[model samples]
Target: MSPRFLCTLIIVLGFVSCGLPAKRREDKTKCPHVKAIRNFDLHELLGSWFVVQYFASSEEALSYGCMRPVFSMSSDRLEVSMNFTYTFTDDPAAELLYGNITWEIPNPSRPSHWVHAEDTYEGVYNTYVLDSDYKSWALLLHCAEKSKSPRYLSSFIMSRQPILAPNVVTYLREKLPRYDIDLAYMFPMTQTNCSNTNRESGLDRDTVRYVIKQSESNRRHPMKRLHKP
Candidate 1:
């Protein structure tokens, strides 16, 4: 073959190689695998979860407090309650703030919700990504709205025990960005008591059970001890 022809052939091959289709790649190093949450069981999902790490830019400030949030499935809808200690920076005296939430199933065919707070101003859409095994730990996503950008809203590292496993922490860090979350400013909760117990029935665990039981009791006539979740 002629040298000129050979050079031309090589150039063509290089172009073809460069243009070839490759698997779509994304920067998911810090994101969680969001698709894994699609199969969550609603019946087993009702309970309280404490916030562990949260993205700064999201509505975490108002949501952050001694008590985080509790989720329950009512019929086909989701009922949520945000419980937290509200401390005025100026006052230093802390007061409790509780906000209620209700979310309808996103699509009739899907178990997801376009959740909003019961109060209008505090409304935001969220998708529950992770449900605790016994409804213990949960990971919530603040999906982007028509007027907003995508964000990782709330990440709760709840457990039957107060403190979560170090492995759980590692898993959360690894999985969040796979769902397009940015964790640059994600903050951990300061209430160590909720995250430092060894017994499964410690403060964190009991808090979750008590909250659910109380809600149920309020609805039902008398108190009943159901199986621990």
Candidate 2:
């Protein structure tokens, strides 16, 4: 099969098998052209962050709980990797899913902007740090597009703590509408009753690197799913 068709098939299979949320259609309007924050410090942004609120134009509602991502920057500061663990909100067992996402800083001058470096991802995926304070809270925007296709957008409001102050949440939430994010669906993620389950799936630095390495070695075909559960 051709690469494009294989990509489509992989995406469809991912949504079906991973308990991933089925994608909802976006508003017909084009994706908003947004800007990354100026002088975004990669060092300051490194570390664990709890996702306080998540907004994906492609999702009608929230699907994950206890969404946490730990960011690590390479010593050279050219590559950034995210090791995250999350459970589906509807899941009774609350089974955690571990995933890795890596990106490269195409331009060190624009450290806030990154391009997905994983071959598994089939599109032109770009991540932007719209705003952040590096201590208490942060606002992030991610956009992806492929030839002639409508861009896909998703955002995260992250806090160093499980819960962010309401006023601060509101402050960050206000920044997304300009990018055409719907306020009503910006769902709060549940951080209660969550913990690292086993040693193998632990999100520590060593474990994350091992898991990612294993995944990289197993990728033998273009049809492998791009989006992790």
Candidate 3:
């Protein structure tokens, strides 16, 4: 079989065999900080999503270039993972970065609204799907408390395909106000060169070690406040 066809088959199989959600407390807020899509299907959200445009602040813009968000249902919660390469300077060689986070439908009644707890980081992400068609595009908000003192906010526009349609971009731009998201900080990602990179099955070794090391060290440091910095 052709490589393209094989790749397509793998994604198709992934969607078909996506795991079921575990029992969790349902979130029942009619109007969360960000509006979530009504009657969203968690099952339909399995597989890989390409981020077309994203908005982030200076504190969070550590990496860039070709980010593909992958989702799968774990034994209890929805597992999210991604691996990308970024360069600190204009160098040809880039270093790989792995991200891992888990989510739960805090309120099953509101399927589009979810909560994120990172395995490798120090923040709890409140995620809301503003819109999705289960096929083409998805607009998500990532809100988290950096610490007891400061908060962080960002938004992501993901698509089944790498390119976001002009109309879709316009639509999301106009809708940003309702969620209190600023378009001025938005950054458009580059996806063309990522097609050649090999996708890792899960988080790499360095990421795993970092998490373990942090968790151990955090024992001494009071966990009273999970600082975002």
Candidate that scores best on lDDT: 2
Model 1: per-residue Cα lDDT over 71-94, one tens digit each: 666554544344332221111122
**Full-model lDDT, candidate 1:** 0.46
Off by over 4 Å in 3: 1-32, 59-63, 75-91, 195-229
**lDDT, residue 118, candidate 2:** 82
lDDT tens per residue, model 2, 25-119:
55533445666567778899999999989877656777778888999999999999998888766444445677788999999988998889987
Which pairs clash (backbone N, Cα, C closer than 3 Å) in model 2? none
RMSD list, candidates in order? 12.8, 14.6, 20.1
TM-score of each: 0.56, 0.72, 0.63
- Candidates 2 and 3 compared: the better one by lDDT is 2
Error of 3 at 110 (Å): 1.3
Instruction: List the candidate numbers ranked by lDDT, top first.
Output: 2, 3, 1
Worst 10 residues of 3 by lDDT: 218-227
Off by over 4 Å in 2: 1-31, 196-229
lDDT of 3 by residue, 50-169 (tens): 877876533334235566777676655544333323222121222333454566777666777777645544556676778888688888876665444345566778889989898988
Candidate No. with top TM-score: 2
Candidate lDDT (C-alpha), each: 0.46, 0.76, 0.59
